[model samples]
Target: MTDGTDARPVQTRRNLGIDLLRGLSILFVILNHLGLRIPLKKTALADVLPPWFLSRLNYNGYEAVFVFFVISGFLIAGNALQRWGGLERIDLRAFYARRFARIVPCLLVLVAVLAVLHLMAVPDYTISRPGQSLPGAIWAVIGLHLNWYEGRTGYLPGNWDVLWSLSIEEVFYIGFPLICLLTRRRWLLVPLLVILALSMPWTHAALRGNEIWQEKAYLPGMSAIALGVLGALLAARSRTLPARTTALLGWLGTIGLMATTIDGAVMWHLLRDGYMLLLALSALCLLLACEQRQRRGDWHAWRGLDWLRSWGRLSYEIYLTHMFVVFAMVRLFKLAGGDLRLGFLWYLLALPLCWLLGAAVERWLSTPCERWLRAALLRAPAAADPRQPASVAAD
Candidate 1:
């Protein structure tokens, strides 16, 4: 289907399995928010679904985000290698131009809407905390440290709070190219990535009890990206796995992913801070398997997952704008006297609306703005180096 895992610039062709993983991860984010805003009770969903399956379906947002971190790292790094020939050969200005074009348009639109909403004194949209202000939040976002601000002052409104992950992603990319540049000079990039990623467990452990820091901190999040980079480097150099080996990895990934979701409470108790690291690693394995299988063009196209495929394709837009639909649905549910009986129905409505909003934003805003900015900003294409080989498509 050539469905890419991220809203990125370099796309020769994409793997279907990667799209499915992205789709699943974003779904987790939505379900997590839905459960957070209006707590899903046993009385609501347990009547039809089994307790184990229902448990898996609830509050999977954070783990799903880790999956994204890995996928994003894998795609961006793999694409860079395909485009520029090597990480060290990366062009800093061109890399930044492409990133700025793709990311900033939607980001600015989101924050502008948020600023207007907060100014209007909407219920859930307000920066109600005594310590938080509109200007401060905006500055934090600009500085790529929104996560730090939230850790110190407490959570912002739902719409703004989602930017925590973006903060982590921004900072990681800021360093990603720089690290690649350093590899050209003298330092070994592979070992450097390894050392940084190995430090992830300690980063997670250091702030184990701090809820905001654990989820939003830079080191822990960047580590996942590093692991993903390593995965890409490995895939670029390694031979494809045989069918049996691919099957084994596929089973391992599916079981581990499901266990983390379905028996989340159990995994939480067993792994604690290690839970996130485990999730990221499992994602790494699954993506590698998908990459190998995809190269052979041997994957089955499941018609039932087309909706999720759409979600994955528009994941970047959906991730930013879905919360607006969520809050609106919450408000409507409140007008309905906040009945739990209707909570499930709100989810059904919210998902399609999120898809619609995401589609509209992509068609009207993100894509057009990206094209305009790229034309204005770039003197040369980001992918072609002329000195390097042509960009190759990958999972």
Candidate 2:
């Protein structure tokens, strides 16, 4: 039932729930970005939306990014654990190559295109800061080091705001595999969970007052990832839980998410601690629910949602690239003397445009580049096998 390593080709078909969640999250992210432009006026649409919705929307789009991280943890860690016996069977070289192939090509292309736009003195779009140089920005985006620096200040350099989440993903890419490699003992999972629980308070306390904490606390965000990894471990080791229990957990998880949203809105600073715990618990519950559905053979099937799942598959691209497109759109609108006012109609128009641009990048540029890189990397090792000394002779 896994996507990556199952002997059978993993179903490329989309799961309805996952896709819907992904699309919803991406939409929220866009709204959040747009909201940043409009002030919180009493008469505005921002004032009409529930405080919970506003809380969930932005402030660096943490909610969406958090959902993404949990899903990645569930899927990636689950795959790693399923193939655990093949611990030695892992192709570290290929694993890294695949990771690079998946991420780098689309990113480099976007960076190059953006750089060209910057140089051409494109009207209405400004890329450089008064004191910051283009080479530094280029280096930051490419190296993924920008998150640490840019996150410290509340300022994002132009259209590159989305790079922060990509930085977290890159960190996970390095850390999660190593965790699987090192925590081979079955008993280690317990200690890992314990350590994750213990680390949260420290993370919250250390980063609480600092604005950068919003970004730097990505390490604390690993708690949810650990929750997902724990779910995978359970799935790998145990049969289905009681159906009633699964249903309860699923409902509880949904409720937890709602409660977290409400609490975040009404008592944000007061309930911050409890809200963080709830977010982690909610994500864990979701993982449990998905596992239960898989066991029951109740696969999600719906055409519209399947399309969302396809977008989820390309979410990394959408997440990383969408901000640039959005900023560009805003600049264009501004130059055309369009109002910066927020409204249902403006958001409605913007949503489809963002999705369309994301789809275009995924199809025309990202997907093909990823495919070529993967094919080249996978083929290169096989093609060069003759160059290796015989294992028997070396031994």
- The numbered model that scores best in lDDT is 1
- Give all TM-scores, in the order shown: 0.91, 0.81
Which residue runs of candidate 2 sit more than 4 Å off their true CA positions? 1-14, 39-60, 83-89, 121-131, 152-154, 267-270, 300-310, 332-342, 380-395
Give per-residue lDDT, candidate 2, residue 41.
Answer: 30
Writing each residue's lDDT as its tens digit, candidate 1 over 28-128 gives: 89888887877666437767767566555667898898888888888878877766767887777766766787788889989999999899998888998
Give RMSD to native, each candidate: 4.5, 6.9
lDDT (tens digit, per residue) of candidate 2 on 1-395: 32233343222323345555556666667767866653223115555676445545544256666666666666655555443333323446555665776678777887787677778877433455454555766787777666665655455454666676666667766765666567756587557765774465467666767776454456666765666666666766778788788889889978876666545564347665556666666866776776676667776467756666555555666776666656765666667665544434455666667777777876787666656765577664222111111110000
Name model 1 segments beyond 4 Å from true.
1-11, 185-187, 380-395
- Clashing residue pairs, backbone N/CA/C < 3 A, model 1: none
lDDT against the true structure, per candidate, is: 0.78, 0.59
